[model samples]
Target chain A: MSSRRDILDLLGENARYTTEDLAHMTDFTESEVEEVVAELEDAGVITGYQAVINWDALETDAERVRATVELNVALDRETNYGDIADRIAKFPEVTSLRLVSGDYDFDLTVEGDSMREVSHFISDKVAPIPEITQTVTHYIMESYKEQGTEFDDHDDDDRLSVSP
Target chain B: MTLEPADRVDAVPPSGIRRFFELAEEMDDIISLGVGEPDFSAPWAAREAAITSLERGQTSYTANKGKRELRTRISRFEDAARDLRYDPDEEILVTAGASEGLDLAFRALLNSGDKLAVAQPCYVSYVPGATFAGVDVVDVPTRAEDEFKLTREVLEASGAAEADALVYCYPNNPTGATMTGDELREVAAFCREHDLVVFSDEIYADLTYEHEHISIATLPGMRERTVVFNGFSKAFAMTGFRLGYAMGPEEAITAMNRVHQYTMLSAPTTAQHAAIEALDNCQADVREMTAQYDRRRNYVLSRFEDMGLSCFPASGAFYAFPECPWDDADEFAEAFLQEQKVAVVPGSAFGAGGDGHLRISYATGLDELKTAMNRLESFIS
Candidate 1:
């Protein structure tokens, strides 16, 4: 009946569960699991299967720094916040962008290889855009949590392997 | 110059599950499905309440029959969940887990030479507990056909009529079987006919999936003779708290409380505080955990079926009792552990009619359960 909901719930917990595993776990057969997944995709409910990684744990030289920029802009008679938001959202460095209320017109999160690169992006690229009255950028120092996951903490299932 | 233990203690054999638990400890990277408790941790609200109580120096022992506040809450909780009522002060006696409650029930209701009929394949503690309570045990085998439920036919065939009391567990451990309301009515009539005092263990009452648990004690003419034992361990993920309560007639509860006061005194005050919070605010958590177990239960059942092993349709608790492909469950379980690094309890450990099967628990994460099932399928192949 609610096979779609069952599959979605299992995948939502761990997106890496394969179709074969889903079949064994669910009442749906292997082919049925695939069909359900395809149906969900077609309906645009499932956009992608993502791996949530802790970027700070990597030991690469190109360490990324993230910043949240609040953009306060003026809307002209012809140009509105939607047009300006679209222009800023197209930047490769922009990871998240939203039209926010209160003092800021658009709130955005940007990631770059270094602080200098991110600062240069806001100064050169963002400031040049017309209708941009003010900008405030705050670089994240440390992440305690993100995306419903606690940072720097690895989950260990401490239950004994077997009991009776 | 030699010391000898009590004869009765020496007479009873040690548990069969202990051997597997020890062997599993020595092995490396063994994925186990033998767990008898929930994998989830205790609710945060309960833990927070316990901490607050402890910080306030609430370290003294509670009343011999447990705290009045907790008992009132338990009484109300039972009334709401099962429509069963207890007079909080005289009809409810909280103990240290259902284990102690079983022991107290045996001593309270049965004499030293009296017989205690127990349903098999039952929990590991019942037989030994009966022995420790100085009562004779009669085993009544409940088959998969009966949904592991005790019935008139099985009871009559077992010589339980001669026994003074009976111990029954629903949403049974190892089997994960439950009794429907109609089925329970039939058993109640049987008990009434034989004048049997029943020790109803409903520890997994809140863990039942897809159906509301109907206590046998709720049926007419059954409450006076039944002592329903339930606890915080299974449903609330509070196994370590070691708190349980027995609800029954005033006479039996007073008798149980007398023994409890002289021997164990009372359940821990900290655990009682946690339990109070758990009963008050953790309904949603209990429902969520039950729903999670239900999904994993279906997944494990399908895996066993695909492997050509027939499993009882377990609609309650978190276990799947499936027939072992091989005749000897012990040999099959050992080889499964050795070859695939996966551990499952041999069904024979649970007693009569439990042979030629395996008890697989589904109270685990979906990822780990998937891995264990994959390993099991490969081993069987």
Candidate 2:
């Protein structure tokens, strides 16, 4: 049976426990935690790990701005696009990246203090990529909810309509 | 009886909120702001009405339209509270909740491939509901500068005015924004011109602190084009009870009733009895609760503002939409939990206009609200 510890890490907070800490939390042996982690990694589920930094740590002065860059790419250029995304994803400003359907191919979430910060990243970093053809940026004007894998309650029937 | 996959199949996904809540339950010291349910209990009179009905052997199924007393009470409540008049026998049909009324409206009025002009920063259910009814939804984003309230200008700008329908929800859930009389008048006029059916959700009507809630059905000629949806959930603090009703023109009501009769048959008889009392006797209770929500709403708005998070003052309902410190609102909300131990929903759950904002629900106790505020400050600062 799959460990309950592994389920919690996937569905809830991924950072809630270290391998050893999860072993303790779930009252399992350390080997059990290690085994679960290994299985998850082999399955390509536990892809990567990083620290979640506090927003206050990033800014010295001025307000914060967020923008979503919608990219359109063809299927034929998948390998080249992956290489481009890998390089762009290395930027300190980029937070999340997802391949989406509809009008855009890849949705890149970026944050900075001003529109210039976002524009500079797009022009300096993203636009230089070879496989990218079109891009549309949506500056987030307001938010109602945003919890990465935490509080999102998306139903399968979620509909998307373009804003003209 | 043998059933085909199409006949027996279910389409809507199971609610993720409840599943997440169950997961969070295993973690100790987790304070949840996940539920959209009210924290308050149903009033004693409403409870007593249910008990009385059981004692009087009123457990049998009611008429498909609902109990006559409940229907009459619903009509009076609409006329007295929202200035909308309807014939109890022809124009009012009790539903399981506003959810059911919303579903009935979509199922009855919408043809396949019809486009519904939906305001963004709307309740999560509206999109899914439209989809299940086989209609396409076109989102019209209500601006942050305008407090996320829907206006005729926003609707007109969508260029889908010629579409089949409009799904309206004010005293709205996620944003807590509402439409005023002037706005409703313009919407009514526009709908009349386009012959669009308006599904107006007034579930939070009595909870509005800024202005008296107005019904689009009350507008001249709007009764024919508007389906007014309301329930006991918000106003009477009866979310678990699940009693709601819809009012509209006789023809529309009849069509919706046909769907309701087959799908639901009738709402809970005990709930219907209790709902009648809620309509008749719970006005004062609603006022007191609304005042409490107003206090919490004001408190949360000020808290967010002081923390340098840009927030819009919520005009109705019990939520505060505060800007998060990250570009991805989801990342911000999750980081907040890791740092502050406070849980707030990421704005992206409501659709496009919600990025960079998080919704904080102030539906718990004053002390819990204060603790959440302090945790939020500690995290943000």
Q: Quick one: best lDDT, which candidate?
A: 1
TM-score of B-chain for each predicted structure, in order: 0.98, 0.93
For model 1, the stretches where C-alpha displacement exceeds 4 angstroms are A1-3, A69-88, A98-107, A122-136, A152-161
Against the hidden reference, what TM-scores do the models get?
A: 0.91, 0.67
lDDT of 2 by residue, B1-67 (tens): 5564442125655443333344444555655565576777888799999999999999999999999
Relative to the real complex, the DockQ score for model 2 comes to: 0.01
lDDT (C-alpha, whole model) for all candidates: 0.88, 0.76
Candidate 2 chain B: worst-modelled 10 consecutive residues by lDDT? B15-24
Model 2 reproduced share of reference interface contacts = 0.00
Pairs of colliding residues, candidate 1? none
Listed models, DockQ each? 0.51, 0.01
Among these predicted structures, which one has the highest DockQ?
A: 1
